[model samples]
Target: MSLPPAFLDELRARVPLAPVVGRRVKLTRAGREWKGCCPFHNEKTPSFYVNDDKGFYHCFGCGAHGDVIRFLTEQEGMGFIDAVKQLAAQAGMEVPSESPEARARAEVADTLQSLAGRAAEWFQAQLRSTAGAEARAYLDRRGVSATMIKDFALGFSPESRTALKTALKDAGEDKLVEAGLLGRSDDGQTYDRFRGRLMFPIRDRRGRVVGFGGRALGDIQPKYLNSADGPLFDKGRLLYNLDRAGPVAHKSGRLVVVEGYMDVIGVAQAGIAELVAPLGTAMTETQLALAWRQVDEPILCFDGDGAGQRAALRACLRALPLLAPGKSLRIATLPPGEDPDDLVKRGGAPAFEVVLDAALPLSEYLWRSETEGQDTATPERRAAVRQRLKAHADAIADPSVRALYAADFNARFDALYFARPERPPRQAFVRGARYVAPLAGASPALRSRGPGARTASGEVTALLAGLLTHPGLADRHGEALAALPMSDPRQAELRDAILSALALSPDLESDALNADLVRRGVGGLADATLKSNRLRFSFTRRDAAADATARDFGMMVDTIAARTRIELELETATARFRSSLEDSDFERQQALLAERVEIDSAMMRLAESLRDD
Candidate 1:
C-alpha cells in the first residue's frame, strides 16, 4: 500500500539527505552541498553531489540521480518497502497502518497548504493594487527595490478584516482559520489575522509557501508578527529566504545569517545572495542545524550595540554543546548603532564584505566577550576571570575541543598575568643602604651600567627575595609584578604565593606575609634561593619607607626583564640575518638589519628611563 503524502513529506524534512548518504559515502562540504566520489562508478573528480536542502543526491559523472529513498534502494540494495520502513524509523515516524482517520487528516493538511499558498498570492496581488499604495511607498522609503519586491514576493494585507474571509468564503472558514490566514474571535466572528501590513512569505525547503510574516505599516507596538504554528508552519524549524539561498550558498561556500526579514532583503540587495534570517526570534538549535547543513561555519552578523552583542554571546554559549569537529559559527559584530542592513546601505557590499572578512572565530569572540573591560590586576579578579573561562570551556561537549579550549584559555591567562614588561636596573648599595635614587643619563650603549645584562639564576633569586621581604611592593608594583616572567618553576611558584598573600591580606606585615608564604609551601624555597644568591641586598635599610623599597624593587625587576628582552631580540635578528644570507633573501635580510637598529633605539630608551641613585 502507498504511504500518506504528509508522512512522506515530514520524513523527507526530518531525515536530512546528507547523513543518509554520508553513512556510505565520505562526503565533504562543497559550497552549499556535500561532494564526494560517486558510489555507483569508479571515478574520482568528485562529481557526486548531495544537497540537504533539496533532499536528494546527484552525480554528474555517472548520471545517478535520486532522493533519499532512491539512494538507499540503489546503494544499500534494499527493497522498496524495506527502504521506506528504515527511513521512517530514522525520521522518528511510525509506519502508517492504513486507516480512514489518518487519510482524512492528511487530506486536511493538503487543503491547508493549498489555502496558505493561495493566501500568499492574494496578498501579493493586493500589494500591487491601489489599496497597497501605502505599503508600496513604505517599501520604497526603506530602499527596497522593485526587483526585490517581486523576487521576495513582498505583499500587503488589506485593512478590511473580512475581505479575505469574504473572498475565500467558498473555501470554508475552518480551513482558512487552520491555515493561519484568518482568525475567529471569542464571539465566533471571523476576521483577518494580518491587516494593513506588508507581508513576507515563508517557504519550506521545497520552495512552497508554508506561512507568512507581516511587518507593521506604521508605528505599532510589535513591529513584526509571524504566522502561528500550525500543521504547516513552525517558526523554529524554518528560515526566511532559505530556499533561494541554498543553491547560491553552495556556489559561494558562505551563508550569512542575519536577524530580520528586511535585513536579509537588504543584504541580498547589496549583492550578497547567500543569506538567511530567523523568523522573529533568536536562533534555535533546529535552525542552527539547518544552517550547518548548508555550510561548515555560518557567519553570524549582529548589530554592534549592547543588545546585539548579548545576543551573539547567547548564541555562542548555546552552540558550545552542539559543536562538532567541522561545524561552528563566526561572529561579525557591526560598528555600534549599526546592523547588516545599515552597514550595507551606507557603504555597500564591499564595506560589509570587509566586516565579514574580519569576523572573529567562535573561540576568539568567546575570549573577548568574557574578558573585555574586565580588570585582572587584583588576584581575586584574575581568579574570577580564570573561573569564567573554565566555565565556558567546560561547557563544550566535544572532549578534544573542550580540552583544547581549556588549554587556550590557560595560555591567554598566563600571558596576561605572568608576562613581564621592561624595567630599570637595581640601585647599587652603600655600606648601609638608606634610599636608592634613579640613575641619570643612562644610554643604550651603556647596557652594563643599568642592569648589567646579568640574569644568572643567582641575580633573579635576589630580586625575587627582595620582593618577598617587601610584599607591600607587590601592591605598589602590581602591574610589573603581574607581568613578571616566571621561566623558573620556583619563581613561578613564588610569584603565585606572593600574589595570593597580597590578594588575601593586602595589609599583612612583613613577618606575617613571610609566615603566610611558608604556610603556602614557598617560604622554605625562598630562603634557600635567596641565600644561594650570596649578593648584598641594596634597599633593606631599617629607615627605608615601604614606598622606597617598592620603587627600588620595581626598577630592578623591570630593568632586568628589559635588558633580557633586547638581548633575545638581538640574537633572533642575528640568526635570521645569517639564514637569510644563506637563502639569498635580501629583502628579509634588510628588514632584519633595520629591525636591529630599532631594537637598539628601544634599548637606549629603556636605559634612559632610569637614573642613578
Candidate 2:
C-alpha cells in the first residue's frame, strides 16, 4: 500500500538523527556537521559527514549522500518504506495510512500484526501462571532467564486448541490468520494452529512481530509446529533474532548464526547480542542477504553433525560467490552431538565465546577437517574426496574466492600425498574434466548477459546496498544510490515500496534490504539489481560510477530479446504439434507451450514495466 508523502515528513520531524546514526557509527564533532569513518565502506580516514540540522548528508570519499530517509533505507539495506516505518516507530508515532485504499490494506497487515502482538502477550502472561511451570523449567534447564524470556516475549499455547482460538476470536481472528497464528476451516471457522507449544515470536530487525516459532511443551504429536507463511511470515526469509542482533552486528561487523531460538536467546543472554538463527530449514539466500546487511562477516555456528555439516557446506557455497571484497564467512563447529542449546546448558554463555574464537575461515575448515587423510589408500577414494571438495569450491562464483580455494586445496592435497606411503602419478595420462557439468535445465544463455549491465547493476546495487547497511551512509554520497525511474515496475515497485515506507516511517531505518524486500515481496528485484550489477573498480573507492542507468537499460533489452527468441521457438514447436496430433509429439509441444507461457508472462511484465515511462 502506498502512503502519502506528508506522513514521512511528519515522521522525520518527530525523531532526532543523533540516536539513530550514533548507535552504529561513532560520531565526533566536526565543525558544523558530525563526522565518522564511512560505515558503508571500511575507511581509515573520517570522510563521511552528517548535518543533523538540515537532515542531509554527503560523503566526499565514495560519493554517497542523501536525506535521513535515504541513509536509513540505504544503510540498513532497507527499502524506503521499511526504513521510514522503523524510524517512525522509534519516534513512537504510528505511520497512519494515507489514501483510503492504502489505509485499508495497511489495516489488514496491522490487524494481523496487532493480533500476533496480543497473542504474544497472552502467552507471556500464561507463562507467569501455574500452567507455564514446565515451560519455565524447560527454559531453566536450557539456561534461559526470566529477563531473557521476557525480552524475547516467549509464551506457551495451552493444550486446548480452542483456548487460543477463543482468545483471538474475542479480540480478532481474521488478523490472527493473516499473521499466521491461526488457520481456518473450509467453512471459514477460525482455529488456533499452535496449541500446547512454547511460542517464540519472530521479529524483523526493527522488532515488530512478523510471525512465531513454536516448540511442543510436552509429548505433543509432531513435536514441533511453526507458523506457516502468511502475509507477514515467510519461513524461508527470516532469521530468528535479527531485531536484537542488528545493532551489535553493525557495530562489530560480525554475525553469529546458530540453529535455533534457544541458542540465540542463550548467546544473547550470555552477552553476545549479535546472534541470529535459521528456522529449521537450511540457511537461505534471504537469511544470508539479511545478515550481509548488518555485518562484513558471518559465523555459521551449527552443530557438528553430518546434517549440520551439510547445512554449513550449503551455506558456505552460497556465501563464497558473494564474499568478494567487502564480505567474509567463518565456520564455528561445536563438539560432536552438542548444539548451541546444549553448549549453553553445559558450559554456560562463556562456552560460546570460546567456540567463536576457535572458528575457522572457510578454506581452513574445508581443507583441514573434511579432507584430512580419510583412507587415501584407494585412488578412487582420493579422487572422490577431491571431486567432492572441487564441487564445493566450484560453487564459489567470485573469481578471487575460487582462486583462494583452488590454491589452498592444491597445497593441502600435495601435503597429503607427500605423507602417503604410495601415491598415484601427479598427473593423469588423460586429465579428468576440470569443472562440473552444467545442471539440466540450466539456461544456456544465462552466462551471455552483457558485462556492462553487470557493471552498472553491481555499482548501483553495491552503493544502494551499502547505504541500506550503514546508517552513516546517510551522510555520504559515496554510498548513495543513483535513483532509478519510479515508473519502471521493477524499480517503480521498489520506489513505491520505499515511498510508502517513508510515509509510514519518515526516519528511514532498515537492518537489511533483504528483510524489507521480503516484507514487500521483492526479493527478486533486490537480487536482480545486485547480482549482475557489477563494476571494474573497488566498491570502496572508484572512478566515476560506470553509468548506473545502463544496467536497467541492458536488463530490459536482454529480457526482451530472450523472450522473443523463446516465443519464436515455442511457436515453431506449437505449430508442429498442431499440424499432427500424434500423442508423443503432442506431449513435447505441450512442454514447449508451458515453458513459453512462463517466458511470455515474464516478457509481458517486463514490456509493460518498460512502457511505464
Query: Quick one: best TM-score, which candidate?
Result: 2
RMSD of 1: 23.5
Tens-digit per-residue lDDT, 1-613, candidate 2: 4667788777766776656777667888987778888776678998777777767666655555677777775566565678877787788877776677887877777777777778789888877888888888888877678899888999988777688777767667766677787889999887888877888988876677878888997786767677879777788888888877776676567789988888788777767788898988888887888887776678999988888878887887777666675577789989989888778667877888899899898778777656765777888888888777777677778754564465456556655665556645333122153221122211233233321122223334444433333323333331112333222346546434443333323455554435666676776765665454443222222222334333334444355445444544443333333333346544554565466568657755654553323
Q: What TM-score do all the candidates reach, one by one?
A: 0.56, 0.61
Give the Å error, residue 516, model 2. 40
| Every model: Cα RMSD to truth | 23.5, 15.5
TM-score of 2: 0.61
Worst 10 residues of 2 by lDDT: 434-443
> Each candidate's lDDT (Cα)?
0.74, 0.66
Off by over 4 Å in 2: 1-16, 22-31, 35-49, 53-67, 70-80, 87-106, 170-174, 185-189, 320-322, 418-613
